[model samples]
Target: MSFEFVGKFLPYFNDGLIITLMISACVVLIGTLLGTLIALAKLSKIHVLRWLANIYIEIFRGTPMLVQIMIGFQLLGKIPLPEFQLGILTEDLSRLVPGIIVLSMNSGAYVAEIVRGGINAVPKGQTEAAYSLGIRPTATMFKVILPQAIRNILPALGNEFVTIIKDSSLLATIGVMELYNGAQTTSSTTYQSLSPWLLVAVYYFVVTFITSRLINLLEKKLGKGYTK
Candidate 1:
């Protein structure tokens, strides 16, 4: 409400923003890579691989991400594996690993569907032509199919990026100290819930708005290449 309150809460929220961005960046990279593999598997000639990929996508996509985060956090920490015993994955930083995994798995499910659709949208003639020219199946997929599929799917992936940015706020529920968590903490300590929450909303708006605009520009740029 007051400018003083706004100024006071900005610092904490800003720190939270950094964490949110870090998580989002990792999620996008991991999700996109895993999702592409899942999509390819779903399209495979082999039945078993296709079944397994479908099961993964359906389970993750069908469930709530919040539940997945909680379960993953608990399950990953209790694996009793070598990595768990290693210094690299102490209990203090363990939660973050699961958080990233949960986010990646959730995002991967959606991305898999997007990729599958994009690949399907590519013309069959393109693959046939590539084959006629003596291109290997793998080469045809990587060079010709995926390239165009990426173009078609870029906008959708941008939308997913934006969605993940906002969704990162949900990590606050697990004490990840993202924007929402920071605001919650500040509100509790300062008893200025109204101002802290409003400010967090503004921060979300600004980041998502800028990202959406950038995505629009990228779409136009990619579209130009396709049209030509």
Candidate 2:
């Protein structure tokens, strides 16, 4: 039999796309914040904090995100156990929240290292110079160290966004209807393999490519002033 996608199903894919973008945006935002903190902790002077940060980074960065998602949901199930109702942990939480949590946690680990390296790469003289001006440690970090580090980390952070976008596909396992899942449902109904997925791939490529181009433009702008 011939295949076709009805306009009604169009909404499914569209809504799926929206959910995908939403999840990606949330993951990126949460990931960046947590990642920045992790990066700072990794660079901390205290041994225990640095060691724990390193382990967190290693475990997440070293393992696949899919594994993290699975383990997170499972652990969520066992959390607080029967002893504590801990109604805070519910089944619905496993469906979408866990995806976000896992994505952010995993992405944060990698982004942390990137951020740490970026901060370290900033000249030590800059930090000392800021301190010489009587700037507080926090002020120096934000105004001097972090500003320069962000300039260096922009490209890598952009890559992290792209990775989060792609990793969202794993959400389907938990009933999150993202692009890949949308395409799968459509293909199942239409019985046509490549056409549905080809369109899906194009959508992904277009979104990622446009974002990448923007990143390049920002990189150039930032690099120019820094080079001066």
Candidate 3:
């Protein structure tokens, strides 16, 4: 509200914003990779692969991400995990891993659909031409189809990245200390709930706004190359 409150609170919010960005970056990278594989499975000629992919995509895409996170986080404690030699990844890291996994799994389902649509958008003739030239199916898909498909879907993927940023706040429920959690901490400590939540909301808006603009510019650039 007031400039003084803004000055006092911005630093705490910035710290949380950084963590949110870091988590989103990790989620997007892992999610996009996993999603692409799932999409490929969905498109594969193999029946079992397609069925498994469908199951994964359906379960993840159908469930709420928050529920997914809570389930994963709770299950983590019950499972026996191997200790890491690095020791850097201790209890806190253990807590974070589940949240990241949940986010990636959730995002992958949506990204799979985007990727499949993008792959389908490529003309049939292109695949036929690649086959005619003796390109193996895998090679054709990886070398030709995927590249073009990614270009078509880049904007959607960027939007996914933005969405992940906002969704990362959900990790706070499990104590990830992301933007929302940071605000919650501030509110509890300062006893001024409105100011902290307001600041974090502004932070989310700024991050998403900037990200959307960059995505738009990238879409335009990629479009220029593909125009007939």
Q: Write the per-residue lDDT of candidate 3 for residues 130-193, one digit (tens) a residue.
A: 9999999999999989989978899889989999999999998887756787688778777885
How are the candidates ranked when ordered by TM-score, highest leading? 1, 3, 2
lDDT of 1 by residue, 1-228 (tens): 544655666667777787778889999999999999999999999999999999999999899989998999788855543322221112234566778889999999999999999999998999999999999999999999998898889989999999999998877666666778778877887887588888888999999999989988988887884751
- Per-residue error for 142 in candidate 1, Å, reads 0.9
Error of 3 at 173 (Å): 0.4
Clashes of 3: 0
Q: Where in model 2 is the C-alpha error above 4 Å?
A: 1-3, 6-8, 77-94
lDDT sort, best first:
3, 1, 2
191 Cα displacement, candidate 1 (Å): 1.1
Worst 10 residues of 2 by lDDT: 82-91
Tell me each candidate's TM-score: 0.91, 0.88, 0.90
Worst 10 contiguous positions by lDDT, candidate 1: 83-92
Of the two candidates 2 and 3, the one with more favorable TM-score, higher being better, is 3
lDDT of 1 at 196: 81
Clashes of each: 0, 0, 0
Which model is ahead, 1 or 2, in terms of lDDT?
Answer: 1
